[model samples]
Target chain A: MNTATIIAQEIPDIEKIRRDFPILDTKVNGRPLIYFDNAASTQKPWQVIKAIEHYYTNLNSNVHRGVHYLSQKATDAFEASRRKVASFINAEHDYEVIFTGGTTESINLVAHSFGKQFVKACDTIIISSLEHHSNIVPWQILCEEKNAQLKVIPINEKGELLMDAFKAMLDETVKLVSVNYVSNSLGTINPVREIIELAHSKNIPVMLDAAQAVQHMPVDVQELDVDFLVFSGHKLYGPTGIGVLYGKEKWLNQMPPYQGGGEMIKTVTFEKTTYNELPFKFEAGTPHIEGVICIGAAIDYINEIGLEKIDRYEHELLEYATEKLSEIEGIKFIGTADNKASVVSFNLENIHPYDVGVILDQFGIAVRTGHHCTQPLMDIFAIPGTVRASFAFYNTTVEIDIFVAGVKKAASMLG
Target chain B: MTINEIQDELIEEFELFGDWMEKYENVIQMGKELPVIDVQYKKEENLIKGCQAKVWLHADYKDGKVLFMADSDAIITKGLVSMVIRVLSNHAPEEIVAADLYFVDRVGLREHLSMTRSNGLLSMIKQMKMYAMAIQSKVKAN
Candidate 1:
């Protein structure tokens, strides 16, 4: 989609959306709840919650085994969820989507299965500095095991990936390139389309960790032409245990099965066993049935409201939050990427993020205060952690005002 | 009789120690108020993991009520531990489970704690609950 057209489509009604998430209505510490932990996991809407409750209360049975009505209903619903996930990301076929325990497991599945089969000694894998540990560690383990070289694409102080550095890293020996579509720590929306195209030009497979990006904006795998795209359900207002790993059909067919288990197998024998096709080959046991069903409901909810709407509202929230947070004395905002998501990771001068988080909690404001699983990124900034206030479509300008006031109070107390 | 009443009594008792900032003196004073656990009950099994400060909790179930004794190496945490034990101790397992701790905000201690210490408090409560659950399960098993 054209950038202008995308922006125009992305407007949301913030107050109306806030009501969908029941947890937002409660008090955290006597004060009203101000949830700023959207990046970690979003508060679930009624639709997603109802979907889970309905599944267990009505169609509670193991899928793909029994011919009984409950089992068939369960299997049909589960498969329908798979189809919904496939269409959500604009995958060519439903089989391209493999469900796992979230983005971490999705990345690990590719590393263990695809990496083991394809990556060999002397090969290279390229990753950016802004990657979450999930994106970085899996490749590091894979490279270490295969005796492959891991090349890092450096980021500028602004937290944007150096396209020149990325281009320089690419070569014929580069087996894979993995980068996050949006940084979890910095909220930098990476130019992933260019990165994918560059890697593809070198005939190297590209995997984009869309764990953070999928919530912020629409992810069209076909448009990007990425070899792999992975995201978690919880980050998108779904249940925690479910995640999606979208790979090209050719890659899916070529990679070996991740785990040997009942559901993933065609037959069981003492000597050898054949694996099931595409998704079933990767998903190993009786999966997180309720979580998967809830993810479908989440996707339906997002679709009905529209990704464009959510994206526009979140962008406004980010800009407002950034301006307000920047105004506070002794506050230094990190990751000043021009194009960014709704996260404002910052540190108050001389005050630990933990201390800042504690005082904020007194005001019933919940913000993430840690490395955000991006330790390498923390190392780049030469800090332990930042007080991260990540926004959602439901967040408001007034909430940002409250957050700023709370931050000001913390500063005075700590100072 | 109720968690709030116990909390009120604790606030009244804690005021005798003076400022909350003088945590070390407060700890010593609070320690004096703490009823002693049996010497035989003090063991490595009572220790909590992941706390930078040493904490030991011992519990005994009598007449379907669970009584607990807790101590910590750090003063503020010890005071906090004492506060938790005051309400939780000498309560039935079911009563302890039913008690809502959201009123902890009223203590005004959360602002003083770092996020890690707050997490430790949460972990301590979870451990207490787990202990209660273990006791309940054992009774069911019997």
Candidate 2:
């Protein structure tokens, strides 16, 4: 009906793409479902869902230890997933990839093992204000145990990290720098390439919390020269309870095993024990086999449509939503960084975000409200929280229109 | 009115609404009309946990009846809080403790009473019942 809406409807074969996700066709509150919570977790396409059903139906066995046929089959499929993930992120080696419970565990693996190995008292670890609590809390725990100081790179009013402040904070005492490639709360695509290069120049390793970044864009770790990267599977349209932690082989070799169990060790004795090599050193247990394999299927799904196309389409949705939403009265847009992904965070004047979200939910629009596990970021904005509408490729401009209308109704009703 | 009678009255009133939006509009109006809690009692200790919106509930026991004052930063939550207070306030502690609170479901706002809602209506109800039971014990002691 508006200019932005008209332009965004031009993306081709969107209906076909939408058909792949059965949930997209489902109803919520007697209205057609409009899923805008992609930042939280994405809906699975039939391909990825079928991959899960297929894995359990045929290949169900313990990987890496089985002498039986099913075990070898499972092992081959699991290792093949590792390889797919390695190539998906362009990791130098498949052995460099470690499967953890989720992004939180992957981060803890680094914070615990890497921290135990390298971090000492008085050493500084730097993170950005835009980090989710997953990235913040692990470092806090690591710093607390190691008696290390954790520093934050402050952000401006627009939610963009101040690079000059980051540059000034870099020194010999700073051991590792961890920040998100894209802020989960703000949708700011951080200048990670620059951050990685800068940290590398100081001989400090950099870890990227790519939980919000990997699915939205094609992340080539070698191209970024990043020392470590982490992302969750569910966010990428895969099964839940699985995540990828990609570290340089050098760093993975140096860090001790994260957990002591059957899969992570080569030999065990009363007085002497040895950990397994590279990824097994960090994995520590039988991994989530279904999650691992189906995440590869999710990758295949993303590749089928291509990340660049998905990125472009989602960006269009973001722009259209932002434009349509701005037309409403007294609506304040939060996190207006120049570079953003498929997210728009905003607040209606004098109306609580929870109130807005409740109204929107009635209209069958699913958006995230509240701090989004980034309470510190909410404090920085000096507001209770903002209504966040995040998009995936399947979401269309018509849905955005309904969402905009719902928000306008909410604002007028609550104003 | 008795607790069941009050719940029946609420269910009757809610049945008049044609849709969820109209129902929500009524709730928002009720939120605007809610009696504000005293500023002194709006402290962190009185705050309800496990809610996206901050709900502050304070109770007063007088003449064997538990009177409640509640507020929330979010208007819809405040509205829900007001509905809760309307149902159970000015009742004997035992009656308040034993109230079924089926009106929340009968009125089609059952989702708010769900544990996964995070709106704190369920938590608020629990807190209010807990307060009443505590008062009931102290009254027996006297």
Candidate 3:
């Protein structure tokens, strides 16, 4: 069968899905909102929003300590969310899942705590060129403090990791390998499973920065045998300020607690303090209670629709967008990895990405335009930035048509 | 003409546009018409800070008036640079410094003034005034 026939088969009810997000019904700049910045943050469905409201209204109490009724209920829901996260990623144990502020905090937790233990002077840490600043800066800080060296895995012209070079970089000096599962800037899906296996072969632990991965694909920690994995809640159709750090139980036991705070402590004394165990050791303070519960709700929402369907639907959308956008004259695609997610990063000839972004905004089409926190990648491409439009499952082909028209208009006006 | 009169004229000119596209078309036209900055003055030192687009601005004090020349890599930003230069250029330092640029809002381009916009038009306006002030101080010193 042809491409059109395959794409036409068994698509999700996008109109119904759009209704689940009330913001999709709203207008921006007197035109209907065309939200294409899903790679930044996905819109919260009503199920997730209602989960937040219900938590605050009915169960407004602290977890892990209070003996009262609401506290127990809140704690139950919060822990339930943790369990949901564990199963969502196929982690071996629920306790292995630690909650933090967001993916940045999660990565920092691993970088600081793991760095304090494993990384030392003359040691090396391997990260990729496609990393967001969150991943790069944390490792850099750790490397600086420990007098360790931070090595970068370079990418090809197609924005793919040079796997041979990565193999050469892995040696006894390397303590950890941290890389993004998906490139937020270019949408290049890294061969993380191969990366994990290679790191494991050399006895180095690998941490997959799944901040841009979890929402788009099914990630299994046990199956991938990943040492550590991190992802943000907001990007997964959940609330902000909540994220997950899935570490192997062995690593969690070895690494120190990220912060010294109330929940992170087992007992406190003037002389010395004992840190808590497993997940709470990293949690630190009173967590984002509602955000945690709503993550479970968001997972439920995704599970109900099914990731397979969302993945297929979004891939089709990406193909449609790519085909339509390619028709525009003087347009150059930035990242064209053989395998990509639902993101398109490109630029019009002689037009700054900022100008395209401004014009698209005037048309009420939301797109991200900048270095995308990957300035090193931008330097490699020898451009300032690209106009990136990332799609979620709720976006329709009609919206893509309008987006293409907007780009055509922008090209004509600016060309 | 007074800075206020120039601003009023700009506002009147922008009033003829039908929608955002037309307004932007006019802005792009103005940007295209803007005189190119001198290559020497377009160096790193003249580039405006806090602009998403690269904007190089240079000011010269000649005949007791501040003459401003500016350019930007982006057309929209260059247009905004042109508009700002129109209101403040070729005028006494004091007049340019004291002028209120109400035409931005009147032309429905207040969004460009927001720090979040990152267009650097706000920074450009501020830089223009600072140039005027610096020139004024230098004139007094002389």
Candidate 2: which stretches are off by over 4 Å?
A1-10
**For model 3, what share of native contacts is present?**
0.56
Model 3: lDDT of residue A410: 95
Write the residue-wise lDDT of candidate 3 on A1-415 in tens digits: 7544665574646677889999998888899999999999999999999998899899989999999999999999999999999999999999999998999999998999999998899999999999999999999999899999999999998889999999999989999999999999999999998999899998989999999888988999999999999999999999999888999999999998888888989889999999888888888888898988999999999999989888998898899999999999899999999999999999999999988998999999999988888988999999988999999988888899999999999999998
Q: What is candidate 3's lDDT per residue for B88-121, written digit by digit as tens?
A: 8999999988888898999999998998788778
DockQ measured for candidate 1: 0.05
Candidate 2 lDDT tens digits, A1-415: 8655554455577878889999998898889999999999999999999998998899999999989999999999999999999999999899999999999999999999899999999999999999999999999999999999999999999999999999999999999999999988889999999999899899999999999998888999999999999999999999899999999999989988888988888899999889888888877778899999999999999998899888877887888888899899899999999999999999999999999999999999999998899989999999878899999998888899999999999998898
Listed per model in order, the count of residue pairs whose N, CA or C atoms clash below 3 Å is 3, 0, 0
In the range B28-142, model 1's lDDT, one tens digit per residue, is 3564467666666667888774323446788889999898887654444555677788789888777777777643565556543454554356667778888888888888899
Candidate 2 clashing pairs, residues 3+ apart or interchain: none
Please state every model's RMSD to the true fold in angstroms.
9.3, 1.6, 1.4
Reference-based lDDT, each prediction: 0.83, 0.92, 0.91
Give the C-alpha miss distance for residue B3 in model 1, angstroms. 26
